[model samples]
Target: MRRLIGAAVVGLGIELVVLPLWLLPRSPAWGLLLIPLTLLTTPFWSLLHEAIHGSLVRDRRANDAWGRVLAIGYGAPFALLKSGHLLHHRYSRTERERTEIYATGRWASHAPGYYLRLFGGLYLAEVASVLLALLPERGWAALVRRTDRPDTITGLLFDRVRRRFLTQFRLDASAVVAVHLAAFLAYGRYGWMLVAALAGRGLLISLADNAYHYGTRLDASLEALNLRLPRPLETFVLAFNLHSVHHRHPGLPWHELRTAFAADGDEFHDDWFAAVGKQLRGPLPAGTLIASSPGVRRH
Candidate 1:
């Protein structure tokens, strides 16, 4: 309940506080807002992200409910975001068992960097297609559900077409549309820039996320949320910055993370990069200077 309230308050605060500055009259300071807003956007995503993984809710349904709300915040059509993330958990920190899941800097020079960055960009796209083909759609509602999928039935990923349509809903998505509307009337041309800054914010979020949990497991309590990271970057990213710990203890809520970290047992902390390197063959799918042979792909 606290996290839910936090999400509502934080979401509104983001649009209210950050949007205005971006919409304000032209000034050199507007550029600075990008850095801050980029930072601001991280917590918003982290809180809701933790919520979706069931770490923030006592009841599983509540987790599902909030996850839907989070999806709306990101614009709903992201099937890969929901599914891809869960799949990463299913197969964590193994290069040979899972290709391209880890980014120890061992990627082939030939790998399509742009396309690969877009979620298991290769594997899950094929999975989504096969899933759509094979998964049963019962009844008429199911028949009409060009968007529905096994994940929706089991509450994994949101439906397929709904994900796309709702995600792509330009300003018409009721709550989100209202947001864009306010910015449009207020900032006019500059409103788009404010919105565009969120893109940079997403970049930051992804980078920090990779930095925090990079090739680690979240099978126990608070592991992902407790890993060490630079202190200066912590608050800008919010308390949930203790990512490995949070992944393990998903229900801890953003506010409780620090206390949880301090109170956690010996297992809660780790150097994320080093954890994966122990038995890892060669460099990770991404490469690291410490490996034996960078290109020696293991089977």
Candidate 2:
């Protein structure tokens, strides 16, 4: 209940108040709010992530209901985010999931894509994916079939997409589009502000998303960096900085991740900000790093 309420307050506050205030003619002062507002997305996404893992609330149905609500405000469909996240756990560090890896001698070719994903491209892709919902059932299925590979992310998502799932996905996706469209319309002449805010949110999310897993061992599904942060800051982010601990104990709620990390006697691989910075070094050849490689430690 607290998580749901907090998410609602923060999500609605941004949508209803902060954004609209920015559009006022004399709202230059309102621009200051954008910094904290953008930063809030970190914890906002953490809350949605909790719902995704069924830890936001004990009641599964209620949890999912709140998750869809939060996800809609976050600018994507809950089902799509949930599927992709679960698949990340299932396929982490595999070729299908290694965002920071490239084939030998392909670094130059892969660098642009890697940098794009590092910035804001990942979230933009998620927002754009709502277009799939517009397709007819057969068209959606055919597209998925053409793109799906058993070892790939598309395959992972497609494998879980039944008729009922598709119906729900489409409904949730339509809701997402509707909500954002309404926001855009409300922004009127200041619509560019909404776009800029979303771009900032996307940049923050994309930059942090892969920080924990960047340059980790291939096929090490449970591996991630336990990036360090001060205790207060870590708590502020809902203990999400303890990535390796959460991966090892996915069922543990965010509040319990710190306890799990301490109980496991694990070490932080790098400072949180530093680890995120390391991604800027770009892609490396696969197999260049091992599970316990020094590179992983450095990251």
Candidate with top lDDT is 2
Query: For each candidate, what is the lDDT?
Result: 0.46, 0.81
TM-score of each: 0.53, 0.92
The digit string of per-residue lDDT tens for model 2 on 1-299 reads 48445755676666645566544446655545666777788888998899999998999998898888888888888888998899899899887888888755677898998899889999998888788887876786787778786446876675465343777778888988887788777667777777888899999999999999887777788988998899989988888999999999998999898888889888898999998888899988876876554334454
User: How many pairs of residues in model 2 come into backbone collision?
Assistant: 0
lDDT (Cα) of model 2: 0.81
Show pairs that collide, candidate 2: none
Candidate 2 is scored at a TM of 0.92
lDDT of 1 by residue, 1-299 (tens): 57454755665555545556543555645545456545565666665566656665777777656665554455332233455466455434433222324444434552455324322333223222323332333422354445443322222233433344333322223444454456556656566665566556555444444444433332221223244446655653456557655555655666676777677542334543443333232224433322333321121
